[model samples]
Target: MDIIDLGMGNPDGATPQPVVEAAIAAIQNPANHGYPPFMGTASFRHSITAWYQHRYGVALDPEGEALPLLGSKEGLTHLALAYVNPGDLVLVPSPAYPAHFRGPMIAGARIHNLILKPENDWLIDLAAIPDAVAEAAKILYFNYPSNPTAATAPRGVFPGDCRLCPQVRDSVGS
Candidate 1:
């Protein structure tokens, strides 16, 4: 019998040449023969810095903020471990990536789930968050380019407010 495999998240197009080339290079590199730095490398961090400064016009101190992860999922989990404390409140959006929920649990934080519905254009309602939850929340998980739903938010939805500080880390992702 002929068996076949199926998967999700595979690229619809052929793998790009540069990425293929990089993979070949990694296979041949003596330096990558073992486990690389658990925290990633300087060169990777520098590239992230360049990308942030050039594309986003956001300046980041590579040494301070550039974190190269195996993938965003693992990164967020470990990040929660680093930042969250026992009994601290975490705000998780409904219909979110499982890691967002699992991360908080791994870190021993209490979860305060808030529903994000389609009628709101998938934006978190500043109004919808309960006063008690908002007051107690120590982390907020936001995802855009949202999976399983294509909803996008105008930058206007974010007010650039600094006052939501004590409750959240002001982080967003996709």
Candidate 2:
């Protein structure tokens, strides 16, 4: 029987030649053997900042701004672990990457799932959140260009003043 597997996030094709070559080269290098520094090498951090500058026209201080994580899912989960105490309220969009909520779950935080609907183009309706729930929420996780749904959200979807952080209005301009 022939089966089509779509659930796994495997690439449709073999690894690109340049990438494959680079990986092989790195594996052969003695310097790449041991575990890297916790924050990654200064060169790697600098490269990240440079990429941000080139791609988004954003200037970042490599030492302070660039964080080289093994993967976004792991980083996001660790972020929840770092900030969430048991019973803290976390707002998570349903139909999201499992890691978005899994981290908070592992931290023993109460999850308030914001159900996304096709009618809303899979966008989170910030206005739909109850005032009380918004006020109590400690962590709010939202994904744009969503993983499985591939839904994109407009900038206007985010209000200037976040209910969780009223002071962020100035920082997050309307």
> Per-residue lDDT for 52 in model 1?
86
Model 1 residue 33 CA deviation in Å: 3.8
Candidate 2 lDDT by residue in tens digits, 85-170: 99999999987788888999999999999999999999988889999999899988887887656799776677775575454445
User: Candidate 2 — what's its lDDT?
Assistant: 0.85
Per-residue C-alpha lDDT of model 1 across residues 1-174, encoded as one tens digit per residue:
763322223466698899999999989989779886766788888899999898867799888898777787888899789999999999887767777889999999999886778889877777667777878888888777654345676655665563344223244321
Give the candidate number with the greatest TM-score: 2
Root mean square deviation (Cα) for candidate 2: 3.2
Q: What is the C-alpha lDDT of each candidate?
A: 0.75, 0.85
Error of 2 at 31 (Å): 3.6
Window of ten residues with lowest summed lDDT in model 2? 164-173
Candidate 2: the clashing residue pairs are none
